[model samples]
Target: MNDKMNLYYLKQLLNKKHVMLVYAIVKMSVYICFVLFVFFSLFSIDFRDMQLSQSLIFATEEINNSSSLLPGVSLGYKIYDTCSSTTMGVRVAMALINGNENSALNEQCTKPAQVLAIIGETQSSVSMTIAKTLAEMVKHFGWTWVGALRRDDDYGNSGMAAFTEAAEQLGICLEYSMSYFRTYSQEKVLRIIQQIKSSTSRVIVAFVTHLDFEILLDVFYEHNITGYQWVGTESWISDSTVARLDKHKILQGAIGLAIPNTTVTGLKEFILDINPLKSTGSTIFTEFWEALFKCKYTVQNDSEDTTVCTGKEKLSETDNEYTDMTLMPFFCNVYKGVYAVAHTLHDLLGCNFGTDVSVNSFRCYGEEVYFDKNGDPVAKYEIINLQTVEDHHEFVMVGIYDSSFPAHNRLSVKMASVPVSVCSESCPPGTRKAVQKGKPICCFDCIPCAEGEISNMTDSIKCEQCYQDFWSNPHRNECVKKEIEFLSYDETMGILLTAVSITGTFITIIIAIIFFRYKNTPIVKANNSELSFLLLFSLALCFLCSLTFIGRPSEWSCVLRHTVFGITFVLCISCVLGKTIVVLMAFRATLPGSNVMKWFGPPQQRLSVLAFTFIQVFICVLWLTTSPPFPFKNLNYYKEKIILECQLGSAVGFWAVLGYIGLLALLCFVLAFLARKLPDKFNEAKFITFSMLIFCAVWITFIPAYVSSPGKFTVAVEIFAILASSFGLLSCIFLPKFYIIIMKPEKNTKKQLMSKVPVK
Candidate 1:
């Protein structure tokens, strides 16, 4: 039967192994799958093709050809060629040409043809007409768009009425358009469009100042104004303006344009090349003029009366283009247009998707380009959007003063504006405002701090520091005396009390020993042992209370030092109460049966000492957690260095602890009174009562001393109080008992001492 049972167990164990193996295999498979899923998820991102298109046409005429070429298409699917001048009619032509080219680039040059999006354009009413024309034509391509449409053609001398009529005729929405008749087509048109459509579109229409600004109707291939939409114009395309106007976003589709004293391929190098003393032509036009002059183009002086020959020297008489000039008089922006087209194309056509047509296949190289409300590319253009007609909202009005003179004529051209309030009060002395625009000044000049002042804060309104002979406080807001004056009696008394306590204790110990060695001395035997406990408690209080003198207000010393002192002081008082209880027990032990006498033994005495100490410790911990101290300062002042001080919270909390100690003191007194009737030989009640009275007197005197003392001298007064009370009791009581034990050898009997009656 045993064999059969063992066999059965063996069979069961073998089956269990297979089950365990199967379970392990299943868990491993699950873990492997989960890890694979996570790994794949992290490494793969849905990379859809991106397309960027910017159309800007302004002052230059080159934008006309850009309307048919690919911009970012060669790189991916971006269309960049847009007019950049501020001329109204010309901006229109640039916008149309850029929009058309962008669409073609997206549909033709880009592999896996994608519909073009984003057209840059000017905001002139005429430019809007072209935008409407181009929009209608490209709507079928299913692409997003952006542009700068004019609010009104005020510069066309066409009153607001005329500008609005023309805009309506072109089907341009004014709210989404940037307005202003005068603008740099390349600089403003594209940016305005980007700003307007930035919320939704990443495509743009550039330029609103072209003679053929309304040629946007030709995108239909039939020159028919069917569904085509025109974003804006190039300066060479817009008609002459007739009225007054201000900041506007006319170059909506412009992508990037020429910046004075800057270059496209090597911007950092170009910026470094600009010299303040040279003219604008010296920096950017260097290569263009060199090429032109090499081709024998003559250079003309400013007056046009004089000319320079193709050679490096000046010509006596000729009307030739100043090809040698480093900067193009009005062609620097146009020159950059060629490179812009090349860059945009490169970004769009770099990759070749399968030969399939779909919106998802549209690929743009970098991050999505910026656009205006109408979905035009945010190409380079001048300011086309203005918050107000009269406010100095133009770039020049808000830009900082770059006084790097003649080499850069565009002074007061703002590079950046203060993002937040610049000043809350008058500029600190030494710093002056160069120009003010709203609350923040456009320009500021830093001035050095005066002889006695200091500039501690960033962008300080004025230098501030203490006057001569005055020392700055932690806050640095004001100055105070270098040396503190100890003025009050309270301040002077604590030190005095500590000294007295130390001196008196030493003397008492000596005298007590001298008297106790002589047994014939009746005085030594008469006093009670309870006197010894009184001296011990008093000395403890004196020692602990003296610590307050060393405390100072600071991060390290401020609050903690004061709290420790308080706890120690309370524990000392509790010790005094325990002393009184011992005295009462001695008297009560005279009864035939009294456990109270046994309770007065050394163990109980130690426990009592521990209990008092624990209670004070507990209170200090509570206060530390509940209402911890903090630094104090004034709100109006900004200070670098801070002052620290421990200011106790809620005197009520402190008083509550004091009250408990007071109750203990009162109990001590009552017990002493009850035991006073006992014989003087063993009676300590009289001494206890006297010591309690002395303690009360010292504490009462402390209040007046504390109130009258200077802040720095308050600790001294406290120390004095501790000494007077504790030391006085030592002299009055414990000194007598020591005299019996140490001085009177014949009277010193251990059996007799132990037999003494304990107070109840």
Candidate 2:
């Protein structure tokens, strides 16, 4: 009965409003503490260097202090050290994923753990083992012609194998793949360095941890190996230990992928305020202090050789090596990871600040950290150039690789800042690339294009031929229109030859007039006056025919020039032949048995001249009707010029015409030689012999000169031959006759002519 009454009184007390309000406030306070204790775990390297640890801690603090991220819900974090080991990193990652470091394989988390997100494993090999999505990020960077340098271990071997397969699918050529180790012997390290130095690849993609890279770099420094464009993994790119090395000069102009860095307000001040005395519970702070100040804590002991820390050193004034906010890419990754968990939790709880919230809605420090469909943060990377500034090496953000940008513009690097990693320089215009045997495409020999071919761009594969009417310039870079060339009256050679030809023609005319005026004289009659007049007329025609070759070639000039020359010269030789025959007959007639003089009279001489001239005319007519010469623009002989000259349509016809003239001259010369000893006053046979000799000499030389001369000079040579031969005939044969007819009129009488000649 007593216990029943006590229970009734307790129920009455619980029904009071003030007692219920106090109970509800205490329940709300416990729930708030539970939310604030839920932590995001971060796995980073902190054994040899504490930059990554400091970065993760600073990032977590920044997100926890932000009120806009997760209102009324405070955030907490748990940090784990991987010691830059893949084994340790995997254990850490699995512990975070499984919610228990020692849980059985079958044991699953019945409730969500306080840890929400795991930041990183830092090293690429470790990241590959834990984060399988990192291969996509590497693919996004689009590196081709890359060299793969990895650690000689399971993490590196597996990661590089997967990376190489993915790279092959993306059409990336692996120039060389090599392995390294921190415990490598000096000989082995030398061999690796030699391989790197001899490799044609200039870009080396290193998939090694910071400690392994440092070891490899020591060997590289000993050998003075540099100028390699190192494409680093996240394992060492953001590590200040490598960046602050004394021999960092070897890494100048390196470019690599890095997580984007953002300023976390008040983070620098918080790090600078850390003190050993104030944070005695933090062993990391004490270690960092000793490293920064190069001093250690000493107790009051018997030994007096120890340096003691006063714990009064200012961290801000000292070199805050690991606390540098600017060089902290891993810090930003951890910072974003924490905020991502906070925002996701806020949406999960349906805590609306101003609008309806979704799991994807999240912003921290004014920057959104959204996860992709794969439940991974949207990958964003900064392309950084490791450059030297004020005698120290640091990474400068050169470009951004964002999926939001177009593919063509996505990977834009500052070309001036980026060094070229090619095997050879580019081939300039006017040349083509001649690829070397068993060598890369970039390693080729630049060769000039052959004559008449052109390459108008750099690294041209083949040269293109110019048009038939065009020719390549000296540089072989472009085709230029050929110059049209011919023997024109305006040019010097044409003008000179024309003047000479006209002068020869005028001289022949003047000689003809003198012979006509003294037609009744004995000297003119002694040398066959009709033949003399015909020969002089034919010589004038020969000289005038040379004028046809002086101007630009035309159809009429091409046909008439050679035909008229052949016929006129034949006529001249015929006249000499007729005169030689008459002289021989006259001498024979003066002998005891000589009817030759009567048989070969003026009529026979005329018939002889007409017959020879008619035969040449027939040949000329047949040549014109069958295979006529025509004006031709020849482009093949000279590259920069067009030879505007006549083409001999039939070579046989051209040679036949010249051969016939030569036959007539030879016959005349032979006849003149047989009658040269005759006692005639003038000895016309001697003059005919000399004239035919000069004509034949000129024609024989003209053939070779015409054949060998180029362009306009060929026409000039032909014209020169005509004028020379014609002048030879006129001066040799007619000049002596004119002198006797004008100055020695007594010797020109018929009685003197008959007395000078002796009968055989």
lDDT (Cα, tens digit) per residue for candidate 1, span 1-760:
6655544443343334221100011011122223344677421110000000111122112323344443212222222221222342233223333443223313333233122222222133334333333333222222222333442233232222343444444333233345533434645644543454343332333343332233221221332222212322333222112011211323222221122233333322332232222445332233233333333234445545533333343222322322112222112333343334433433433333432211221212232323345534333222222222353322221222221234234222232321121122334433433334432232345565543345555446565665444445544334554433322234545345545646755665565455545434444443333334443544654555455444344444445554655665555555556666766676567667877867667667667767876876777677666865443322112232222234556555555555555666677667767767665443556777787778777777787887676454565666666567666666555654565556654555655444545435
TM values, all candidates: 0.32, 0.68
Q: Quantify all predictions' global Cα lDDT against the true fold.
A: 0.40, 0.69
- Candidate 1: segments with Cα more than 4 A from true spot: 1-538, 555-564, 592-595, 628-645, 704-708, 738-760
Model 1 worst lDDT run, 10 consecutive residues: 45-54
What tens-digit string does per-residue lDDT give for candidate 2 at 593-633?
76786678899889989999999999888898899999998
Task: Please give the distance, in angstroms, between residue 400's alpha carbon in candidate 1 and its true position after superposition.
Answer: 39
Q: Give the clashing pairs for model 2.
A: 522-748
True-vs-predicted CA distance for residue 177, candidate 2, Å:
5.3
lDDT of residue 494 for candidate 2? 78
